[model samples]
Target: MKTTTTMLGLLLGLSAPALAQGLETYAEFPKDTPPGNIAIAPDGRMFMSVHEFYGHALRIVEVKPDGSTTPYPTDAWAHAPQEDGDGLNGVLGLQVDREGILWMLDGQGENQTGRIVGWDTNTETLHAIHYIGQPAARPTSFLNDLAVDREHGAIYISDTGDGANSAIIVVDLDTGRARRVLEGSQFTVPEDTPMIIDGREVKLGGNPAKIGINPITVDPTNTWVYFAPMTANSMYRVRTTDLLDTDLSDADLANRVERYGDKVTSDGSTVDTAGNVYITAMTDNAIGVTKADGTYEVLYQSDEDLPWPDGFAMGVDGFVYATINELHRSPVLNGGEDASLGTYRIVRFPALSATVSGR
Candidate 1:
């Protein structure tokens, strides 16, 4: 437990909380983000997904440590352009493997297809090693967020179908095998409403197209899979043993579930090596964490342009990084035809109990 005590003098408010930098804004993309999700690569690179409608080509950008960035450009491996129209729409999720490679949830999208792309850090080359949106079993389900378990070479994604429903899609990176698990659970709906922080109601996204289980995360050891519906207040978790085995159907896996407990209204989630689950409380303007014991706490809050803090991932320096997609702050979310997107801020907070550099 490191305690970083940055002077309240560095930021606004003489009475601001005594801690390390609350939120440090990074990048703010000019595009809209329907539901934002972020991930940190093993090498410290950052990946993000923004705006379901126009989130194709430029949606996912890789940020370097020095702040310079280069787009992971490719029609199939990268985000598809908005002009491609519905048939080729691509909004994605990302994960980094143990070998320092990045894997993408290439939501082949409206075409009812998706692909998992692998990018080699050493070569800066993109490889389409896994493809899911095939004709045999095209569900056209919402392929939202992604989490990878390096131990078993598996990746889990949230289907989040258009019928306002949810399901977990598992990809065996080793075998290129994919399947759905843990279906039909209460936590999969958009109105599960168990999220309670300081007794304040966590407001789920009220957007017309919004529905359940938007953000998904995994425990440190990959034992528990945690997820929440974008508009739902409550949160829940189920064991991975049930999700990984093909013999057990989603209905059967759903039966072995457990409630991780409620959270404030949230948009995205991530976990660290310590078994702590971090959630982006869109309504709280703060990041929340669920400890190993099932109790939760507000880890930090943003004071700057950090209006809507979204997806989160821990960086190499023990800093928790997040995409402050500022969805609510976007014009479309605000009900305007040409809504300006919020700053795609990538802020960092010190690890638990970590104090300011000088403190």
Candidate 2:
């Protein structure tokens, strides 16, 4: 296994070790057990979701500083329930909000309905469960990512449909009402571009598969929601006020969508306090940051164990944590059996200058 250990240089006024100048493997998962995303609370407790593709049987778990893992809230929630209207079926996107609450976005799965659950970190109890039911959620809807707009009692989610029905779902925390917007619009659907990883095309069943509207982020001011397709290079944003207004017609909402900037092939995303958006650049095996002025720069690139930096969480401790899970190397995408070696990793670097807003 190749590991690059060096203190990282400080960027954006944040100090990092030289060995870990850009990427640091903070923790490692057992071989074949890839993590989905990482969420760090205000108290520095780190939690991660297990990717269903790896068959971990657990939805989410907490990572101790010593690297031991334990299920969060309870063991039962980690092993999610299968009923349609109850419990989490799949957990992909997770965020720790300003109020010390952990928000979980459960995507559509077998016998599982799309839902968002909020857990109060202090109480260690389920605070709220908002299910996206009926016309807003279809069987094809793959709720891939989320951004919370706590002040407006709303949560924005990206429904990365099965290549044909991509859209954005906005949930009202107050009423548990979820609305699907921009369904099948050019802004939401994936382009016909092939996904490349490790200089090779990522294929499923001998055909290249593309992910649509897979990355979403809420700016620190809670004013805009930025998103993009995992297989595309363009990034776009829409005002939070516009997203929450039910009166706006689909045409009106689509018109409000603003092309923020161009990004590398990205998976998960998070916004820092200064309005800079950091994206997990999977193809480049690094993290990329987009400034408020719509300019982007490769903040950190690595060629070591960080083969694919998939998901991200801008931590309260001024470190941005990511799940270095190489999805392209999974057996399901690799003609039945994975021949890859090395452990799945969780890496972090000094990141956001402040806590993420909108719990």
Candidate 3:
């Protein structure tokens, strides 16, 4: 299989090497449809967010073990209007909790306010829904990723603020109240650092997109929330307690932020039961894992074959699954021409040596 990928790359003029030993292609999307985000349910089932970014209709569907997909919840949730209770504008970051619940953050492509929807995967029933509109978000905000604290009954979201301001929005699950916090911290701002792929800086129309805090995850212990900006070389974390407290002054909460460690240009991340953090090394075209002691290693790497690795989710069956598509090679970034030469793929490898749980 590795040889096949390498051969394909060569034929396309890409100098990609063979995939690392254990990496395997789990599924592939047709050339017309590109993947957006992936999440794993507690029952070992996989779900993918299908959106209009790649010319596909908006929907969230389940990817079965044998490579079949069925619309999750229902087609109604996917195509519902913006004003309806169960309407879904679009889904970006998807997460499944330990209790078999599916959570989705819908950005709706900046035309409307974003909302978060939670559903019981087992029952296929709506559990909770909250709108992050006017008071909690600005029109320029891009609610990129999220970390759910089940025990604390809260959800922490990262606002990328593509053309506006950046901040962390903390939502109280019980009351559906969300407040923006830690606005304008260096941790949430785009650094001067540039993201490179295949030894060349990734640019959109000759200029790199200034992405802010995007990837976020909660440690197994639920004590800390870890996050990083797409343009940064370092990771930052803060106590969950401080983030949940609205009484803390912005300066005081900012003081609580602690630098986790240096990291590469990363997109998505999750921690294993052993407290090891696995991140998508977007620039290196691989998965990078950091130990509890702060050591980093390239867990899996492929040449140009993998493209820009994005979302990650650890399944109950003991493998971490990731969505890989040529995001940097898309027309929006690639001088008005589609550079994503082939099919988008989802790949997974054996999970870490132990169990991983967020609760």
The alpha-carbon lDDT assigned to residue 217 of candidate 2 equals 84
Instruction: Indicate whether candidate 1 or candidate 2 has the larger lDDT.
Output: 2
Model 2: residues with Cα > 4 Å off, grouped in runs = 1-22, 82-87, 352-358
Question: Against the correct fold, how does model 1 do in TM-score?
Answer: 0.77
- Positional deviation of residue 192's Cα in model 2 after best superposition, in angstroms: 2.3
Clashes (N, CA, C under 3 Å) per candidate:
26, 11, 0
Worst 10 residues of 2 by lDDT: 11-20
Per-model TM values vs. the true structure: 0.77, 0.89, 0.89
TM-score of 3: 0.89
- CA error at residue 22 for candidate 2, angstroms: 4.1
Q: What is candidate 2's lDDT per residue for 1-359, written digit by digit as tens?
A: 22444544345544431223546677888864578888878788888888866656788888888877888768778776755433467798988877778899877767667788899988888888888876998788888888877778788899998767889998888888889999888888888788787778887767787878989988878888989888887889899999888899999999999988878778888887777788888787778877778877777776665677788877666777788877777776777667556548887777646655435
By lDDT: ranked, best first: 2, 3, 1
Candidate 3 lDDT trough over 10 residues, lowest sum: 1-10
Off by over 4 Å in 1: 1-21, 26-36, 50-57, 73-89, 134-140, 192-210, 302-304, 353-359
User: For residues 278-344, could you state the per-residue lDDT of candidate 3 as single tens digits?
Assistant: 8888788887876677667776777655678888887777778888887777766666667777658
